[model samples]
Target: MDFGVTPHDGLPLPPRVTICEVGPRDGLQNESAVLPVAVKAEFVERLVDAGHTVVETTSFVHPKWVPQLADAEDLFRAITLAPGVRYPVLVPNSRGLERALDLGVRDIAVFGSVTETFSRRNLGRTVGESLEMFAPVVARAREAGIGVRGYLSMCFGDPWEGEVPVPRVLDVATRMRALGCTEISLGDTIGVATPGRVAAVLDALIASGIPVDSLAVHFHDTYGQALANTLTAVRKGVTLVDASAGGLGGCPFAGSATGNLATEDLLWQLHGLGIETGVDLRKMVDTSTWLAGHLGRPSPSRTVTALAGTS
Candidate 1:
């Protein structure tokens, strides 16, 4: 577990992995308890001070679907942008992208799923149809000189559809690349994967010649397998990971699904193994503490709770 020292060389890892904190969007979106807009902004600022470079601020989705994030625009505008840090918002389509662009967002993430059944249920479009629709969206963002990231949800098992084929996941990744998405994040939407399965999926994707460096992993902790899956992806050369503070979110569509891996837990694991995240653990725990207070529930992160003496 010592990433700093190997069993053979006893030397530290050359570089640590980068973590993309998505609590503001993915974490907050599914909370049944609504937090004040100002509070949400405060939580985001705290995360920045805690050393997160990329904080997913909010999503431009409709409030009707996700009532928890009704104040997406206001929250985005209110957040104190940290120096040397990037705030990426989740923009579903042209409308979402336009809203972000109006708010002066420089980087935005467009989301789509890998499975046809999940795609139709979650996005109201087929996988191919979604890719075709993103063509112009990516074109507009590129013309505006904005950075674009594509998210492929349900990369592992799906609730609606039992298990997702690796080939199907790769096909979606290939389409995202073709749509001008520089980064493709494979999401374990239902958290139904183990390390061996994670390696198999990424291996299939990499074997198809997709640059491993261009891939990221987003996992849920439904089965408490997200961390193991993340380690597998890291060993496979994936450089970016998506996590949420306090593990505060869940999927609305995926039944009984949980939030993304807590930022604190992942950092704890990474730091224990000598992986440098550049994040302040104490500050992250503080933010999670405050956010959990707003929701009147303890954080789902074992690391956060244990450190806060609330577990």
Candidate 2:
């Protein structure tokens, strides 16, 4: 498949892309085992050493909800923060925001859902109610000089509510942007989005006045369409993409939502298309390999699997 092409206007792809590594947080959150703070810190540091600038270190949610990341504060304090590298944590509400702020975190991300069922199931609120909840969180984060990224989950299709419309996703995204989120990441949580669906959503978002630069794409490889969907988004001029090192995480709410788009897998496609991600593929492979050992399993990333076989 020819994955390189501007889907519209025949424009050249961006010179560089930003890959946000969400392994430490999103990747491990759904795992059955909880890694110790020291190991988690080491995993993050290795990712930074591998050249990821925006690494999502952890989430500030309640420990009972995501016990895997219960040591968010300790993990954040233990990691060595390098200059020019961002450590963004996921803050689900004002309480999470407060926790992040207490640790002097500069960047945080908030999540919202397009479908009513997902919002209610994932956040214990309706769609409108969830946005209302995020309003104060985003406002206070901005007041505290924190950069907020918004995540809209189940953008393409919801397991409970199948075939979500683009406008519904755009509506929530627009409100998120208005809530002062610096960027919005459209998440295909169930991995049901194909390349055409991905392109359609991006086109609708861009056409609705959302700057392509302010948008990011997050895909799960459950159905093996992540790279293709990513390519479609890039062709639509998106610059920021989310991936997990070693393809670690899945959505606990969505039963079928499996492994995330792997950092190594996304890098392979981006590098092949001549798009600079400022990431060392070899180093990423090694990091994924090391992480897989810690997880006591082989990496789900095709690139990591292939490279490991050859190495």
| Candidate that scores best on TM-score | 2
Off by over 4 Å in 1: 1-14
TM-score of each: 0.94, 0.96
Candidate 1 worst ten-residue window by lDDT: 1-10
The per-prediction tally of clashing pairs is: 1, 0
Model 1 scores a C-alpha lDDT of 0.86
Give model 2's TM-score versus the native structure. Answer: 0.96
1-311: candidate 2 lDDT, tens digit per residue: 22453235566688899999999988999888889898899999998888899999999888888888889999999999999999999998999888889888999999889999999999999989998999999999999988999999999999988999988988888888999999999999999999999988988889999999999999999889999999889878999999999898999888999999999889888887778899988888898898788888899888899887654
Candidate 2 residues lying further than 4 Å off, grouped into runs, are 1-11, 309-311
Lowest lDDT 10-mer window, candidate 2? 1-10
